[model samples]
Target: MQETVLFVDDEKSYLAYTTSIFENKGLRILTASSAMEALEIIDQEHVSVVVSDNEMPGMRGLELLAKIKELSPHTVKIMMTGSADLSTALAAINSGEVFRFVVKPWKKSEMLRAVKDGIRRHRILQSLAREDEYILHSLAQTIELKDASTRGHCDRVATLALKIAAELHISVDRQREIKYGSWLHDCGKIGVPEAILNAERALTPKEFDVIKKHTIWGCDVVRKANLSKTVQDIVLYHHERWDGKGYPCGLKGEDTPLEAQIVAVADVCDALTMDRPYRKGLCRDEFLRTIVEMQGTNLAPHLVDTLLQILERD
Candidate 1:
């Protein structure tokens, strides 16, 4: 519950001034006069919020905050500068690199409020992330009970999707979102009835119509849970075919989100390996052949190739 804020600036006066303002506010205040020095401090301690000056020598504040993102993604970033530019501020906020952009000659009230908001945001995000871990698996488990055949399907799909994402060199944060998305891609199926889901015979078009509504329902569930857009997209769009022939929406190739495409490939890979009431599971070689053939048809070709390369290496 102890919150720490690091202030980075080139001027010793600004560092002292900021520290004086917050020292008695019941918050831990740490300061560094240069961007390099701030990074050193960050490397050794947990920083809850970072208030950085933009014009520091050797490394700019925006660049430093970018590094902070890699070092501690949950840390809130605030950019302060004397020479505030519209373009830089807009881009940083848009890209989620900066939580607040404060002018150097900020009023005491402004600085205090910005830091307060930053801390609150950081706490909320951290709390949600912590709590959502159980929520995701609980939902996945409940979804699995709809059909005994899919007991561990979500975990298997998530593992394969993560591997494909890694092969594509995705950033750590994005990969985390991909993992969440993969785990809940079929979450909407929770709304479907067990009779249809566990049917021994092939599905009728009307029954399939009821089945396809899972994406729509699943997306709604994720949205209400306050998940990232990346997670919601995967849940809704993973069922979309690469050529646009498959799905509730019939989204065409490349039109679908990349994360969704990656999961779709993973879904097919795992689904083919699992025995259904109607058909036996495919052998590894047969599965590989089927995936290769599905390239650019039912699944994205690039992701399919990425999965193939990963499999080959293993």
Candidate 2:
């Protein structure tokens, strides 16, 4: 396959120098002296990797990377800067805008290696996106096998979530995202020890902390899988509460992604109504009562109402 890398820098000399270095490397190289020019090229070509300079005039590399993320999420972004700083690096990484950070005066071999690795990562992402639906469904089921008490939990959640999404009248694409996210929401639990998951006794604070880390672990699991953003959001934030008392990020109210908020409601309801080693499943009446009590606190208020309406009709 032909791999095309786009290098964006305001300095014409830097662009020319890098172009010369990689000219005979058997890879297609495209250069842009500004962010706008780079975007134009991107619109016309299928770029594999984008290596951008952070301190460009008009549009900073970080800003351009953000736009590229929105424009072509599959394109791998790499940030290269002469004036490297911790803040910039953290921002790029936390936002998931850049795949790699390279200093401006990087070694020729090291830069080449990073670009090659970025291309490989991009290819992996594309391949995962093309994975058959059954394969992904199987992976979700395999994740559930790690916890015996929760067999079919993901499937139930996906069904319930899809219902809620439809009731909410969201787009079909969003509905699909909700379903995919529900199925893979607890995939991070694979990182938790079986003993901890199956413990009938109360969990110690340390043990609970370990369990909470499952969301992060789950995010890491799907990070390389190239799942859609909505799926990722649900997997990472499904445990977050609406009133700001949740784990990981403690996002409050509408600050949490709507998809995550919807999944949180479905997840808790499913868990409450399903059998567990620690407790028996809540009956329908008990489940409804418990959810009503939890509304506006642990779960989204509107979603609670929506779920109630759904159950009432069912």
Candidate 3:
């Protein structure tokens, strides 16, 4: 699909001339005469770039740019103004957060170059977002490898969570969140000492307390990294229980984010069914029975049902 660009200006001649310059670029161009009209177009179209004149009738260029940033943060913003004042340029850069600024009486070539650069910057931001997600997944795998008994555990939980999310009919974006949450659910273990983590025997009170710190530690790690609120919530609350008996925050019932709760159930199921260094894996029937028993007490009841259905289909 051709990328859509929204150009906002109150001047009819300027709008016509500017629109004509990019008409042959194969872009879906939308023009608005006012800031309010521009906002309406943005709401109605998938605008990838927003170009606004610095001086408009109702709303100044900077004001319209700020509103565009608020409405569509991912869209690249460009400010075009007749004023060449230093303060105006600085305010446009700082307040509007424009990707490019073009002065009025712009050469067609310069304006075109600015638009091209804005598109390039937008692509770079998207690539960076993907890289961030890749790095987070790589770290999750590293966390899983820290414990021999839990090797590949995170991957399995993530897979199961995605399946459960599908059964629950979540949006594709939400399913991605569930997958990331499941993979990083145990990331807090990075802060725990290896001895306690790999201990053959049961943990003492102090060791158990230290182990429990992983949830909070993971939450802090993700928070500091500035991950999306949904992913951060999952990492923080994956250890919480339905009966209010689990983990750092003790968030019970619906207080726990639904994606986190789903991950918790998947993680427990995988842990029970997979063989560990210290114990053999449970038989399928026994595993199913155990999870069924924990439904309302330990796991979210709806998620538990979905999980069993997933297993049945498999």
Candidate 4:
């Protein structure tokens, strides 16, 4: 998506020249005369690679790069400086912020090569992210096989959560996190015993306590896998309730991340509508009434409302 490269420099002439040099190289070019302006572009646009001149009016290139890292950690950052001091290069490297450091009055070939390398690195990261997503989906399916009753539960929850996220106008990156998190939300069930999961009888208090540990277990699994913080939160907090009475952490209301909240609604809806070992599945009208009754207590009111609208539409 970041087929665009952003050039940041105080010198308008320099930005124009850089754009001209790269215009025909099959790259979309974006420019800004100040770091603040560049930040605006970065926020508003999908910038794959950023090349910034070190000495800008307000914010230095290194400082701008740091902010950009927070805003879009995957965007490749390249620093250019005419001074090209040893300390500056060391600082950029030490901060782990720069993909490439170029001396000012750059050769055309050298600059082109660095930009190409940055683009290549960005594409590699994108590919790796896709692979990670595939692995997460497979893991979810494997976890489902542990309990026959919940065979397609993860996929259903993911589909419903994604629809809710889209209706809420969540960003694409966050939507991806929601999808991954939904699939992996129940992964901690792997730690539970088969007899307990498959038991047709209602769980005793002690057994229910064991069930609560699944959230923490899921969080541990996600942590060891080095997943994103959003995914970890979902794995741990998807059981949290709006009224602060839920399990594992009992996080209440907005304290739970919005993504987790969205997944929670999906989980509840799916569980209510699907047959469990002990109970019959609810019909569509009953499921809708149950979801509406949960608003402001068991579920986030806005999310419950969004889910109801989605159900009605479908």
For lDDT, the strongest prediction is 4
Q: How many backbone collisions does model 1 have? A: 0
The lDDT of model 2 is: 0.86
Cα lDDT for residue 187, candidate 1: 92
By TM-score, who's the top model here? 4
lDDT of 1 by residue, 121-222 (tens): 989978978788788988898889889998999999999999997888665566777888888999999889888898989999999999999999999999
Which candidate would rank higher by TM-score, 2 or 3? Answer: 3
Candidate 2 error regions (>4 Å): 1-130
lDDT of each: 0.87, 0.86, 0.82, 0.88
TM-score per candidate? 0.71, 0.61, 0.67, 0.83
Off by over 4 Å in 3: 1-122
State the lDDT of candidate 3 residue by residue for 1-314, as single tens digits: 68778888888887899889998898888899999999877655557788888777778878888776644556799988776554786776775478778888788998889888887877786678689779988998898777888988888998889988878766555676677778788899999998888887778999999988888898888878866567778888888899999987888899998888988988899989988766778999999899999998889998898888888989
User: Which residue pairs in model 2 clash with each other?
Assistant: none
**Clashes, model 4:** 0
lDDT (C-alpha) at residue 221 in model 2: 78
Taking every candidate in turn, the Cα RMSD to the unseen true structure, in Å, is 7.1, 9.2, 6.2, 3.4
lDDT of 2 at 78: 92
